[model samples]
Target chain A: MSAATTMVGRSIRLSRRNLDTAIMAVVLPVLMMALFVYVFGGAISSVQSYVDYVVPGIVVLCTGYGATSTAMPVADDMKKGVVDRFRSMPISGFSVLTGHVVASVARNALATFAVVLVALLMGFRPTASVGAWALAMGLLLVYVLALSWLAAGFGVIARSVESASLLGFFMLFLPYLSSAFVPVATMPPWLRAVSEHQPITPVIETVRALLTDQPVTSGRPALAWSGGLLVVAFTWATWLFRRISSR
Target chain B: MIVETEGLTKRYGTRTVLNGLDLEVAEGSVLALLGPNGAGKTTTIRVLSTLTRPDGGSARVCGFDVVRQAADVRGVISLTGQYAAVDEEQTGRENLVMIARLHRRTRPAARARASELLERFGLVDAADRRVRTYSGGMRRRLDLAMSLVARPRLLFLDEPTTGLDPVSRTTTWDAIGDLVRDGVTIFLTTQYLEEADRLADRIVVLHNGGVVADGTADALKNSVGGTRLDLTFASREEALRARSAVGGLADGPTLGLPSDGSAAHLHRVLDDLLAARIHVLRVATHRPTLDDVFTTLTAVAA
Candidate 1:
């Protein structure tokens, strides 16, 4: 437990020092939200107000960007031989992976908060009660945690930092295909199926419903997907860490 | 023994890195695993330090099995790999404190230990600077300082001075010498014969993943035939003629003859070469060093 806390502190410090990535995590999603609500929102006729609709998607997209950034640092530690140093000590691989995952969750929280603040300044309003807001944030936390662990697993397997950044590209692209920026009904039949059936779509829909104080239809699937992904990703990351570090 | 390995073997996709190797190191001694690239020096250190597992046989460190009791092994050992493992984003003090904390030191205690190590390694000036701003030698010193934060009973250094400049190398050597004085068991690997001779009480020559020679530096050197006279000739033909006339070993343009380090023996060899009409360009008596032992042992094994 001490080792885990120490690693977490170290990882947070690393994240703080990495100014470029931190800025990108917060700024990119805000810019994307502005682009969607002002530029693309006028053409879409399915939603009443695009800012309120696009804000939830931007929140999910922010988490995706933040979670995928976890992979690069994890890959750096692995390639730089620090993981070997840690493994040779009494430290467990669980602690090391936990450090990165927790830091990822923290970064996502901050970026999500920034995106929400920008949405409010741009004429977006959420009509949720306090409890609903808490529940929505809690679900977003689970999603971020799951994706971060998944990224850490990729980091362990990636041979270099450049390859690890590819995970970020995939995560950033997933939100566009989901219900983040546009309504699923507005898409082609095949893309609509993809947007409705994928994990990100359900997560975004759940958050949107909770914030808008509307009927929550996707809550169960959102929790199920996030919970299932958390289990698999945590198991996979720790297993890969143990195997690679020991070898 | 602080470290004991019997017939240890490791194969990487059919290429054996450690092939039926055997080794032992007594407590409070410096043992250097001397070998060239692909001789498995790093593998041996990795196996003993619990970073790697051997395929066959077994290894025991500080009375715990390397595979089964790996956690215990880790508890008593620290490894400094070929590369400096310090985090570039963190400051030097932070890196050291992190390691100390991982070793279960209290917050204040970890801080104190980090300060002490930074001062000892002459890194106090750069203690709060990020490792990314450090020079090569400073980073290496910080890497060593981090490894010593826990003060383990045993330390494994795999090519500790491989890429350092000459001054940094000597400073590292001095730091290692200080550790030896503190009675820590050190198992270091190096390709430089001088490093093995200077810091190791016992030098083990590894070839083809096996121990080819293991003894004190002097013992290994004596094993390669001691106190030879190096007779350099102006031409390879003259060296060959001197070798045939005086019954010595011919290498390039030099003939090496075993000598007793006496004036009479030198005179006799020069007389024999002179009578044989072999023109000698240089005459120097060479003492056997670890280089001779390493080359001779590895050459024979090859």
Candidate 2:
């Protein structure tokens, strides 16, 4: 009955309501994985036999790609003056952001699950134990959280809904050029260094390494980078959220 | 008075939005903030609602400081903004229930309240419909209903009837009147002078971020300085004769006399006219409206 509990419950309900789009987001990765594995698996160094290698990458990219739809909801809220309504309510200060972040993450999780099922159909399997799978899922969820916040920042700062979508697109494109799909050595020299050293590269490497029974190079480096990225992204997001919410 | 603010100033960079404003509203009285667009009306509402911090000055709602005691301030106040907050994607019923639940109403009570507000707002017919399907007027009514879910003691309405048709506006005005009757202290910002005249117990005129004028509606109308009596006659000669006898201004068949817009003043003129047997076909008093007060203040600032 207290205000705090009310906020959480309301936020959770809001999240559940919007999660209908979640199934749509998941459909994208599922379709792509199915087509790429069944139709084109024989050509151009097939990811089919080792589809597990690319599943994590596709899941992450798919999540980011679908985030373009997110900016509109936020931007629409702003344009229609719903943010002003939220500001005036006795709702919790952090609950709005919590609702948004959790909703986006939940959507991405559904999409990630679709890709995992597709990978399994293509004879792919995660070599890690259930415990490691849970850890990997945890990392994926955290990554989505930070990325969704970044998307939310763009939503607030963008002058228009179109511009907001552009920002979301730019986020997706940058990671594709990283070591998300292919090894760094496959790229030209300068891009290779950039791709290998990119923040998402270590994360992709850690997930890819886990799924394929690869040694993972101790994974200490990936953990440090992911942790630092989360802190910085969350800090920037919190600052943006506070500024935007107050305004 | 349950609410008072003095020397409240707010600035966005070099542009001052609210300048050293002062206000007082008696408990259970509806105080309407009247101003044109960009007149610091909404900004003032924001500051009091704890959505934005003022640059300087102090605001107290029910004896709670808005800045230092925001949490307590928030407990007593609620705002229904210029537009609706019901998500277009959500059903009208869901929207109302969500807000009620968020205000800590128990599940059964929240559902009951939501259904009550829906019926009261005349939204029961479309309660199952998504808000996007509702008309602008309906959505606005729903928004107002949602803010009332918690029964806040102090409610803020920022141009609550903007973009509504006359009928809708009148309906909204009636709803507001009912709230005042229930002992709610309402703070409203409106561009329509008629709204202020019709609903507000007191009016505050803000210009250039300061309180240019503040008083009851009658007092503010009086602030325009003089009331005019217009008398129209059948002939210009009659008008001229009336102007001469009354020592008033004449144009065509109309003669104007200055008065205080008081019935006693009208009685004196009527008695004098009857005693003199002055022939006049029509006589009407013209006092300044809040529109005039707004224009006068804005022009002075400019």
Best by lDDT: 1
Docking level for model 1: medium
Clashes of each: 0, 2
Candidate 2 residue-wise lDDT, B1-302, digit = tens: 67889999999989999888888888898889988788899889988998888899999988989889888887888888877667787788988877777777778998999999898888999999888789888888888888888888999999999999888888888888888888889999998899999999888887777777888899987777577777888889878877566656677998766667788977887677666677778989787666667766666777
Model 1 compared with the native: what TM-score?
A: 0.92
Candidate 2 chain B lDDT trough over 10 residues, lowest sum: B241-250
Q: Return the lDDT, model 2, position A24.
A: 58
lDDT of 1 at B154: 97
Quote the lDDT for A210 in model 2.
71
Fnat value of model 1:
0.93
lDDT of 1 by residue, B1-302 (tens): 99988999999888999989889999999999999999999888888878887899999999999999999999899899999999999999999999988888999999999999999999999999999999888988999898898888999999999989999999999999999999999999999999999999999999999999899999987887767788899988888888788866678998876666788989998898788888889988889667667766887899
Candidate 2, residues A1-247, lDDT tens digits: the string is 2544554454445545665555557777788676655665445363435366567777767866665455655566666666666666666654555556666766677778778877887787777877677767776766776676666666666777678778666766877787666657768998988887777777787777676767676367667765666677667766876687665
DockQ for every model comes to 0.72, 0.38
